[model samples]
Target: MQMNEEKDSPAARTVAALVARARAAQQVAEGYDQQRVDELVAAAGWAIMEPARNRALAELAVADTGIGNVDDKVRKNHRKTLGLLRDLQGARSVGVIHEDADKGITEIARPVGVVCAVTPSTNPAATPANKIINALKGSNAVIVAPSPKGWSTCAQLIAHIHAQFDRIGAPRDLVQCLPAPVDKASTHELMRQCDLVVATGSQANVRAAYTCGTPAFGVGAGNVASIVDETADAELAAERIVLSKTFDNATSCSSENSLVAVASAAEPLLAALCARGAWLLGAARKAELAQLMWPEGRLSPAVIGQSATRIAEKMAAREGAGRPEWQAIATARPSMLIVEEDDFGEDHPYSGEKLSPVIALYRVADFAQAADTVRQLYAYQGAGHSVGLHSARPERALALGLRLPVSRVILNQPHCIATGGSFDNGLPFSLSMGCGTWGGNNFSDNLNYRHYLNVTRVSQPIPEQVPSEREIFGSFFDKYGTA
Candidate 1:
């Protein structure tokens, strides 16, 4: 092919060069065996696991994004990367991951080359590192496309990964990213040229991935709801909810957004949440909080991922916008805000995900009403995502799990931590959560190495065991006597 360099736009040129390099590197990566692939993953994970390295990236992310606590981001960077490495141990991505002698077939793993991996601003460091490890583990070359807001921090993380590649003498082209100034044009161009796209950002980015005419794995929306049955432990539930909701200032999409509870447990739940540093906003003060949180029917960017104390200040300010007659309980420097829910339909704003430490509470008559309300909440925003249920009775939890459309029905645990994966749960560790078709995604499980690899099935000759027509139609024949 002849070169036509001047005709290409800046974004197009940048993406084309990146993709060309990635494709060349991918050809090299495709030949790696399981041991070499795992070695690359280990080097990347270990480099990110260093405390000093973790602290620097975490600090950079919080400083650049203007969201999340530094300490919490540090912990997230370590734990999420460490957990994913542990989960994939001994998981073969080389030849013959599975062999079935009985069926005379064998399944082998192959790399999905030149992945265009889109990362989000919320968990910039962790999300990119996690995706990088999974891509390398599957022997796939990745080109990271970070959100503009997360570019600097994400670039730093990628630089760190490149250093690891240098240490191991791996191809630097195997790990690439969009340039310093990222935009929609660059991201779309990257998505179009790659063999596979793994997007983990806003709905727009995910939609772009599907529209780019490339094989893709993208994240789904999440307005995570939690239902507290009367039989649940009120205090323990409150503690877990607070821990998850306030972690990194509600950066995770899986953080609990609403609480549907029975009247019997509502009072105790409220009291327990209060004890655990949740500031309950009475009906009288609801308008003020609403004015600050959902100004003009959209979540205020200033409040999203901000501390609860800062939000209270925004509400109590005397001069600027949202000047209210009453200030919140001044002594209550809560980690999360609790609002009494009025409705669950689209008519109500609080029913959807707030992306901050605000949780809406719905007092239903019973557990059935709670599940129904949760379903309605998902219909409005987070359909096919995740929900948390706390109950002493196993059947009640199981019943809701069976009934809800949510892919991850978190049980008696913090939705933020459990929905993704934790040491306590059996789910494979990952940052990209697929919300299934209901949430406008293709997969319903936590994204991992297997998702990044292509599977090839081989068939061998065997004795035929075809079923006779008589045997195949026995049930039909028994019912209608040989039509």
Candidate 2:
């Protein structure tokens, strides 16, 4: 269909109105000084990060989306926003930002105008708040287009943001969201009307953003696979992995879906994971779970982001009239489920992204085999995302980074928290991670304030310093005589 075919449609008209207001607000923001930008960002951050407000948003997010737990959602809202504020503190995104006397150039930062940020239901509150804060930091107004399941939470979040704007005398339109009845048409229209689009949900939305004829920044699908080598501290790795896998019920895209352990480390790691409340299911149970989790090759929405016990109970209910084995496991109250597998790919459904507290385990003969397994898994999915390595040998991480198609090779840390960003890590704090060209994305870095800004370099004439042919190609001529 033509882009203008739906111009008079309700969804398109709604988005067009939101974009128009956003553009007007952004024009006002464009004149903001650095201090004003920082103040506005701080206000937006505080709107979501305040404990009581965060708790409310978290509760509403869980209730609205029926995905993640409320308590962990609260933690994610607070910590992610706090971390982003920490990264953005004192950062200049206005006026003259950089200068180089030798190069006779000055760099200035400007906003990219209204931003259309498509957020996911998995992180309804935190993700949209992050985008709004970053957009404010760059003096750009933002219009959020939340998923259908996440619209209520996003609306409440926008209300909170509007209250903060009122307190600061900022325009309420500076931070807006698509009205009720959010749909693909409105999202496509917003992408078309906005100066830039930052989509961080399904691959379908990302693809739409790219094709919407707008400057877009979209993330890729996540199916993180981590390896534990022979030299790794198996206990520590297991502890970290379990923590990450169980956190928010594996709602984070960075959560490890598949784990590969060297044969020598497998048993010890398994024991440690068990100690950390990881219930290992038998092969028969694994088969049963595969069917329950992926009915007819599609992930069951009922189990996604559910606790281990909940999933076990569902499995038991599915086995009505048979033995109640899964019920017993459910009664034991495991934090997460572990299923051993030897395969990887579309044929092996367990080897892909399971958006719940379930992990697929594989045992390889050595580190080489482990890396190869990770590579093979990436070839099936999750290319240009991230891989984790829990090894004492630094060379293993280097090897993975050099050879793997992934973007980040996280070492000795929880994959979810580390892949996005953490207090101790150097990676930028963000909820959206660009997966580069390998994953069909334009950028390959964490989404941050830099992505919201348009930098202009003012160049002045410099003294002549052109290199002679002898100086420019001396090494090449010495290696092979130049004609």
TM-score winner: 2
Off by over 4 Å in 2: 1-4, 320-323
Clash pairs, candidate 1, are none
Tens-digit lDDT track for model 2 on 253-281?
89999999999999999999999888999
RMSD of 1: 2.4
Worst 10 residues of 2 by lDDT: 316-325
**Prediction-by-prediction clash tally:** 0, 0
Off by over 4 Å in 1: 1-7, 318-331, 469-482
- Against the true structure, candidate 2 reaches a TM-score of 0.98
TM-scores of all candidate predictions against the true structure: 0.95, 0.98
